[model samples]
Target chain A: MKKVSIKDVAKEAGVSLTTVSQVLNDKRDRFTTDTIEKVLAAKQKLGYLPNKNAQQLRGSKTKLIGVLLPNLANPFFSTMMQSMDANKESDVDLFFLTAPEEDIEAGIMHLVERGMDGLIIAQMIKNPERLNNYLTTHRIPYVVLDQSDDHGFTDIVRTHETGGGELAARHLIELGHKQLTIVQPAHLTSNMNLRMEGFKHYCQSHNVATPKVIESTLSKAGGYAAVDDIIASHSTAVFATNDEMAIGIIRGLADKGWQVPQDVSIVGFDDIDIAQYMTPALTTVAQPIETIGEVALQLIMDKLDSTLTHRDQQSIVLPSELIVRATTARANLDNS
Target chain B: MKKVSIKDVAKEAGVSLTTVSQVLNDKRDRFTTDTIEKVLAAKQKLGYLPNKNAQQLRGSKTKLIGVLLPNLANPFFSTMMQSMDANKESDVDLFFLTAPEEDIEAGIMHLVERGMDGLIIAQMIKNPERLNNYLTTHRIPYVVLDQSDDHGFTDIVRTHETGGGELAARHLIELGHKQLTIVQPAHLTSNMNLRMEGFKHYCQSHNVATPKVIESTLSKAGGYAAVDDIIASHSTAVFATNDEMAIGIIRGLADKGWQVPQDVSIVGFDDIDIAQYMTPALTTVAQPIETIGEVALQLIMDKLDSTLTHRDQQSIVLPSELIVRATTARANLDNS
Candidate 1:
């Protein structure tokens, strides 16, 4: 298992070291097709891994973008990452980090220290002004997604979370659900708070009883654990801030011998992949997840390639829609 | 948004540049607590992001580890990654890449070129020999996980795939299911192939009819699309290779007016977080996901610290267990 160098590739290809190096680095227009093929074959046979550090040291673009998300275990985030990966420029490479609230600043700094050309931060930053100051000062191009407010620091790309929440509330209200409950995370980000605001606003405007609120962790377990409280509230319908929690609420209801949309109607936000696969088929607000990912990446690429000026900050907000499924039905008066 | 230099930090802290540098780099024992706090406060106020590349140039350890998994969209992999992130050493940083079949080599080379001290590859390498040669020749400490065969080149950590399959088959059989079906991915990895082999072997040895096989992608949509074929097979029980596909199958069944464990029992592999939250509560083969993640990181750390010898290639195979939830029951003779 000897380390194969450019010299080994050149020797195997019967070419000069320069030819091997040039061909491997995509500087192949000057070389004959036959020579380039031979060099590639030799490199493959030798399992040569070109030292990118050397190229990087010589002032070559790494074309590496760093992406920071809240968590990957959530299908919503994972699917968004997949979309970004699929749509990114073929030559560009992406590295990912899970930057929960506590680690957002550290994650960005880590990526910056590693010399990422640009970054896409998809987590809530507790101190946006400070982070914005750091990125701007260092001249690191970045895009912020899903943050409560951009604070006018960087380009932002996100779905209309408030509108999404309004849609969820409207759909449930149309189904004759007057007494409702909204399950949300205990610690609300600006985005989550906006969603709550929209739902409450819609309910208040409709002359329905203001929906009760139950705070949880924004996970399936969080939703499952809130079932006892939900039962105690005697609400005819519930709105989970996200699909994962909706799935949990469904299971918890079944465990309590209650049928979804029969004894209790439910609405969820974030039409993640599993939402459709839920037995009762989750009725949820559908965020344009793929578009959000694509737009975020495109913004970063634009910044990196100088197609978009850093000073001309842009905020792109995509619309969300309500997708009615079996999870919602007309209120059963007997249950009320 | 002025770029803050070490000189500024020094002036802000009312200390020399050398003192600020030493305090920031953990050389604080020579200074009093008051001076250390001053340096830290100054650094925080200025939002300084230390350039680790300078330290790397001076031959300081980056302590960066690269993790390559097939896809993060799958909860099994995502959860494993979370566990790794939670259990990694305080100073160690993990950067992740999603390497599907075509990108494995490129991803490895990218990480290597980025100067990762050690790597944990959790994907199925199509050509392990060549990659092994490349890694070993470079003296890069690495660990392989979930590969069908190790090829005796590197340390491997995996669950007993064959035994996991056997457990699934035995559970269904014990519940009096005879007409069984196994839904799996069309492109079978060695681990998956082993799971299929074990299930078929158990059925044959028990003198039961060989279970029917349905090939699809290893996703929820794959299982959802196979429902028609499953119904055609007249199987009273089904084993989906993973929980995602199992979820799809359950939904597909429900859509076609069938009931799980009543009309056809269902069992799934990989007891991911959402498995228990499924309406019927999926019966699944549970792998030691957290333990595997922790062990893999520990192995990489051991290699990085020189506590584990390069020549001592360890292959650790953890056991898998079956958790019987409400997804399975005594097979209905009427369905068969």
Candidate 2:
């Protein structure tokens, strides 16, 4: 098959060259919704992979994107990687950080030295100033994915974490759950904090009292170990930040002969593959993991291609929603 | 912490330089059992991280190892990656192939151009000869991980796949399962084939009828979708090749009003993190995933360091075992 070009897309969409360019760069708000839809449809029809070859600032493009992520093995990250791979502009490979807990500065420096055009990073660090300085000083084209950074970096694409938290809380509250336990991760990120804030906002606005927070790891083992505390709290419903913990909670509850949604309803975030297949089928807040990844890669590609008109640092927050599954039910006041 | 060298380990083990080298390269057969134990204990004590610095083969030593795998998000692979990360040489980093299914040849070529010292591959391909030729012709130091390759590659570190198959089958058969169904993946690799062979061999030797094979993806959804056929075939026991399928089987069975072990016993391979925490707690054949990864990385490091006296090829097959959990029980003949 021949490579589809931008000219072909423009002609097919019946739009001006600049309009097509703007639409491609996610300037959808500039155009009417119908025009944006038309351009996208045309691009889809023409099978146009963006021609990023026009503007290659870095000498001889390496066709490699470096991805630095925290908790590399989660389903969410895996799905994100898959999406990024599928939506790549051309034949490009990703250089991944082996351990996010370690010094990521070295990894960033290594990727930069390797002549990669751009990078996607989402890892934790105590000295953010040092990392920011390195990237800015080196002028490496990069974006942070699924991370909330106040740093004046190039760009970051994050899920609507606060919305997700609020969605979960509202779902539980509407189900008549008053006494709730929020299973928080031991190592919290800004996104998690935002999620908690959203949940708190919803609870407070709805006249619900402050829900107890149990600091836990996002792993299944962590959730399993927190069962005693959850039961002891006498809460009717539990909102674990991620699905791994919720699954563990369910299993842990089952081991103790308690039924989900019957004895203790549970809600989780990141509707991972296993969540839907669990015994009670987890009720979760869906994180658009793949979209975030795809969009982040696109932004990086646009930046590398010099298609980004505005050089100012920008953050894109996508929407999140609640997925009601079998694990949650109306609260049982008598049981509590 | 100070860097521990091989010399330090040798001194601690009360062994010569050559003895330490042999032990590090897994030449355990060449030494007495007591000698091997002492060397291992010493190495453990001294904390030797395989100082491949002694013998460097690459022009400048890029210190980047490329890892290619089939599924990106599996717990088994995640655990393996974690182990490899933990054990990697201080300066070495891993460059990962996100989607090995699409044009791995291009990815490998790019990694080679970028001067990756060596590669670790585990992906499905139609023609193994072509891939092997590319590696050999280019003189790229490479090793196949998890997947079994018969194409005389430099090195392959894999689980005892056939043994795993036999273990799962035997566990089910010993439980008095007269009717069994093996949920095989639609796309079978050499490892999966070996697993089936071992399971079949066990059944034949005992004069038991050949268990039917149900072709499915080695994912939860695939296992769940294969349920109707499983029930239709009236199999009392299921031996899914991996835990994902087994979990799906359990969920699918539950959705159809059947209970595991009591109605349909299920056994899976790879004893992933979630297996032990499942509702019934899955019975699975455990693949030493982390060990396989560590050993594979060691082999690659050894090759790069020119520690291998014979430049021919090496294949290391590690042991696999069955962990009987709550998912299996005595066959319900009455239910049948």
Candidate 3:
């Protein structure tokens, strides 16, 4: 059977083609209630199938939002995606794009070609100038979930990395641990930089000597290697920027006959899922990841609605609390 | 600027509207070469913007494939999704739909309404008659993954679950474990059924006492409870249907006075990425998850091409292999 078209509906209603198109697209404000009823009656009689695929492009407002995250394998972002879905009240379609650091440009191009009206990017690559260039060209409104203050060009949603650092540092300082170090990734991304800044601020405020800072990859192997320098310098506490590295440090320390919270008090960030399940539940700062995704989505929706126009470069810095699990405890002052 | 329409293109090319549409939708075989050239020239000259969203509806094909998986938090399925993207040779768009048991019906309907040409579903729930009913009603071509025999209904793909079970059973048996139990989900699916059958067969063929079976939720908590039961019953080895449960069992054992590989040798299936990174690396069976996705896509493409038909229900059974890791070890008979 031939599918019913707009022309058929117009002919049945004895109206102009434009009248049928307007009714189908929900632009009936231009027509009277009586005319809309006639068009609706004809559409129902003819079994006219409104073209959804066509409607996606016909309007300036597509009601489709695109989300570009690093990878779903990371539980942090995966849980955030779930939270974002749960917080939505409107019927908005979500398009998720995953790209590794190398192929981020292609990923951005995919969203642009798809004609996404708004974007939420949680990217961790160094020097995202290429990405910025594309956004500038496309003119798609977006929000950046960043770690450092370097995101001056985009609306940023900041995580309290510095607060988490100060919390961890103060805990150790109160326990009389003078020898300490901060473990982090080599790159100066916002996540790591904010954390380091927080740690430094705590030391300066407390009038303690500057702590040693160790840079390494954000992996278990890096954590394992950083322990060697820590032991050599007789540091009593280690603050890892992320939980994965902290877990690795614990494993490495244990292998070398060092007991957690007994010889070295360790603190990690991001309170990852597996952290609680670990043997010595990590003492970490819990970042509210779900809030980030939810607020980001709301921000984009506001921009799409034309109520928001890059006003004040709003940055929401959610509070982070120190969750002192078994990994951190009273420092043993006799170690020296 | 007002969006250009097909009517404008037709008038510019001095041709009928249908002729211009045919050329745009790649139905050029029915038109003359000169006519095709004229339409192409007119499109380029007028800067004709063929509304992709509308064109998808008027055109015969959408070039969009929908993939439905159980959950993204599971590393196994996430890895499958990642690899599937890397292997796509064409510009096929992938739309991901997550089907929790409660929302599976609604999810299927949503995908159908979105105009997905083909589907690849991960059958996590039993009794797919409702799913089958939906497919039948829509007449949409689809392939099932991680499920039992095709039952002569649809294109199906599966891992050699039975073979994997037998290999795991043999490994445990050779290590001198006579008392064993297989832990799986509460309800039986085809994949779970096959794995259990293979395990029981191995025990029977070796003239060992019939092995015990435990059915619980396929979760960490379930694995934890299963571990307590196995210990109380004095079972020396346990085989979990998936990696998450196996890891749970390991943790449970540790919580008690039992050590992994020393007290209980455990085996799991679907060697997800985290399986290798576990504290005591997991020994389990590995499935070609991404290959299944790629194959499922190929099946749908074939159906679209009309090269394949419903006359024969095509099935693809991929192989599984055993990975030796720290989780399993030679059983000690002193405890027995």
Model 3, residue A146: distance off in Å is: 4.6
User: In candidate 1, which residue pairs clash?
Assistant: none
What TM-score does chain B get in every candidate? 0.86, 0.79, 0.80
Considering every candidate listed, which one attains the maximal lDDT? 1
DockQ winner? 1
- Interface C-alpha RMSD, model 3: 5.2
- Tell me the tens digit of each residue's lDDT in model 1 across B26-75: 98999999999999999888766565655664456667788888887888
lDDT tens digits, residue span A32-151, model 3? 998999999998776565645555654534466677777666667776766676676435666677777777667766665555667778876456675665566455677778532445
User: Per lDDT, what order, best first?
Assistant: 1, 2, 3
lDDT of 3 at A19: 99
**lDDT of candidate 1 at residue B311, scale 0 to 100:** 47
Model 1 lDDT at residue B303: 78
- Chain B alone, candidate 1, TM-score of 0.86
Winner of 1 and 2 under DockQ: 1
- Clash total of candidate 1: 0
Better of 1 and 3 by DockQ: 1
